[model samples]
Target: MGLAHVHWLLAGIDEIAAFRLVFRDDRTTDVRGTGRLVWHGRTLVWTPGGPYAHLRYTVAINRQRPPGTHFDSYATPDWIATRALHLFPEINVRFRTGVAAARARLRFRLPRGWHSATALAALPDGTYLVEEPGKRFDRPRGWLLLGRIARYRHTIAGLEVTVAVAPGSPLDVRGLFRLYGKTIPLLVGILGAPPPRLLIVSAPDPMWHGGLSGEDSFFVHGRIPIRSPDKTCSYLHELFHVWQPFHPSADGRWVSEGLAEYYSLALPYRAGRLSPQTFVRGLALFERYGRWGSDLTRTRVPAALNNSAPLVMHWLDHEIRRVTDGHRCLDDAVRSLAHEGGTLTTASFLRAINQAAGRDFTPLFRRHVYRGEPPPERAREDDAGVGH
Candidate 1:
């Protein structure tokens, strides 16, 4: 069967009022595209060649519905997709795909004081490779083709990448590697060893946003939010969701959001970039913002999309750690759920905790989580968000 596809055409920045997208395919004898355009951000479009000349775009695609199958969850982002795109400020787009691969060709109609470069590097496996091409800032102010090549592998997702610098302005191969080195491991740990495919594009100005759009794997818009290290962490969190292996089936905000939150802390902690105490303090801080203290066990996990619920669960995690001597906690519960094949319920969660603690968690869970009451006043002082 042929893969489903979507096309995206971005013309401007800030508010994308007339953002037009077409979902199409040529698998059948007749080639056609179908999709929708929603009023995005908060901007309007007039003349396409106005200040909107400089733009970035992305297309994301994946398998169709088959609940709990790996296909649906594959909707996450890939790192390489937007890595080079974001580094350069250029645009002009066209697309093509073949039996084994897909490609996006973007051009720089006008040089924005930079050089465009391209490179092709072989992968360790030799069969798979990567081609990274984009504009590199030049001292003399001109265009230099910058790109990299790697052996083509099973998929074009989270593969380790190396890029060639075109007589740089500031960024060099080593510097890029530094960023990649820090980025890939976290990507692998959270998403998997192989990163998902993502599309990165550079904008004339900084915007700092990333997400999945149709036909686009993962779109990272604007200049890299250098100051916001959290953005990259957040990217990994969302992009990895494509590998979730299930869909329409509730993954619980507590599971999804908590995992994202936990990983945001866990990765940095493991890297020695964050102190354990500091991490705990962060959790404590999050506890302060919680608007929930529901009896999770009795509430059936709510199945709601409220973001606050996970913060409440985070507090519960803190309580579980406190009561279970830290040896038995949400980490254990998560692992247990993952072991049980990625489907978790409040009931299953309670059972896991009780099993780990070697005791009944009913009374404890009831008093702390199921009831709307606070966890405990003693545990609430410093974490002002939680009024236990």
Candidate 2:
């Protein structure tokens, strides 16, 4: 039998504390110029001993999983899978000369029978390139998967897509590709920027029961279907998270999640793959869970808050459409929010809404999200003033 291969993106960069790297040789293998590596406690410090200095390091791709428990990253003898950010250690160093702005390349030397894929740009000669203009040291971040795996690669609607699964997964990879190919393109107009590539990895029972999203990548349990009979889709929800450009603060967590969950059903509905009655039923399912949710502004469990969040988006989208005479909709506000950039806050979210609607939605938010009062019901499609 062969190993599994998967691609990943860094999901939680803000909370990564121990950016650990695995070493195999003289630590100076990837280092250059005049700098001495210093170790203080568990932290590694570096300083330029001379002009024109650069440092580099390598990480071991192997990870050990707990025995029969749910985890995001884990490994068996046949393969290794986890967040690249957790695998590659973050470096802290400075340079006085030479452009600190340089691109990073990842070249792999896998076992004789193994294959691998990554979320980074595929360069000529089979290496991956990592270049982020905003950061000094572009650490290898995102999901990293390697094992006796099978990879299905495609280019649909100009987006590079890779679906990796264990050799015998029951997942319908072809159906999933058809679904994503049909719906992901629909998000570009409203979401502003779609990831140039998307990495989807599916494994078996030992993984968490749900899906988790990373940068341009997401992990899902193999048992999950393309679409449930209830009309909700875990794959779509996580894919939305990867496609999302804005990062909302704790107070506005629902804005990001609500949109992701809402669009999971909405995109297929808009694509005519899901019936209108089924779409409405999906919203009702979210509403049913939402009734048990706590306040939106508090730091409560996100799953609990998300039950009602999509219904709120449904109503808000309708409200924006009604007032704008079909000229603007919730997408207008979402675009506005995306333009603001940086960490998204509740105030910024409200400002985006007002900017899009040309009116205040503060009272609405105060009534619903903060006070825990239910948002008003969405009007009928035709009366909503926006074309479906």
Candidate 3:
């Protein structure tokens, strides 16, 4: 084999706080993979050579790395390979001939905090191949994320993918998400397109932010401090915005933010990760925090929709659902706008809303979104569940 330099690859596994690489060559020459290392999960144990590998693993009870700090956590081989198999049952590997190749078979298991899988190899082209799976991808039946990066030395990938954990946190989905919150939305909004890449968080240091400049990849500064426990949904919310059409007039801000918020809870809710009660609690918090105080009353409102639109949009959703007897939701209005192929304005939005409501909601639109008037607070006590 050509003299091997350091290498990397993207693979998949259950979940983990960090990953450790162990490689053995044909000569059984063993080299424990180590570096500015950082950052896997699972319910079912993986079987060897049966499409997956299961290795003994453990969670980091308190492994939260500060915004700029660095730490290391290693995974057993069984854990790494098993997860990889599920992510790519039909694996298509492109390793350099004789330069370096990770062992094809391995085992992995779930221990505590999380379990993960990864592959490390150096290519002849001066690029490293790092593979991992169980990532987020919008592909049909390809939701399972997996890939390898062609990393170059002294570049973004050349820097170590540090391992980290947020201080005073558990492995709860929401908590783990919040650990990398604020930056994820901005990153997703900017980079979440085609050619998705793995995002490695080494330690919880705020200053470690770096990634590809293209409209497809993002690298979390693993060491950044967790700003709030509730910002966990920001990443998913921002990612969904990628599908929305850009509108200069309406800017799709209402639909984009509303849909983002809608899916933020919907996905987890559907997956049983969140309870309806808890979801409503989050909506309550959004209203109380009032991130955006858009005047719903003005027919022509001027404001970039972000965090604030969710609450008001939720209120609109409730009204629509109730008035339409659950026949239509905000989605219908947006779909109508999309099919019409026109920029959305106050008048156009109202037209869509009226079409979905099956009547002229001009008065309601005037009072609600444009006039910013209080919804029929007295009409139905159950309406109290809604907000604006």
Q: Find the candidate with the highest TM-score and give its number.
A: 2
lDDT value for candidate 1? Answer: 0.37
Backbone clashes in each candidate structure, one number apiece? Answer: 58, 14, 76
Order of candidate numbers by lDDT, starting with the best: 2, 3, 1
- Per-model CA lDDT versus the true structure: 0.37, 0.68, 0.38
lDDT of 1 by residue, 178-238 (tens): 4445645654543434523432222211122333321123322323342233322433344
- Estimate TM-scores for all models: 0.43, 0.81, 0.41
Candidate 2, 265-335: lDDT as tens digits: 78888887986667766766766667543677674665545667777777778788878887988888887
Candidate closer to the true structure by TM-score (higher is better), 2 or 3: 2
Residue 159 lDDT, candidate 1, scale 0-100: 60
Tally clashes: model 3. 76
TM-score: which is higher, 1 or 2? 2
Off by over 4 Å in 2: 1-38, 46-68, 97-100, 291-293, 377-388
- What does candidate 3's lDDT look like per residue over 189-240, in tens digits? 3223212332332222222232111112222333332222443254355334
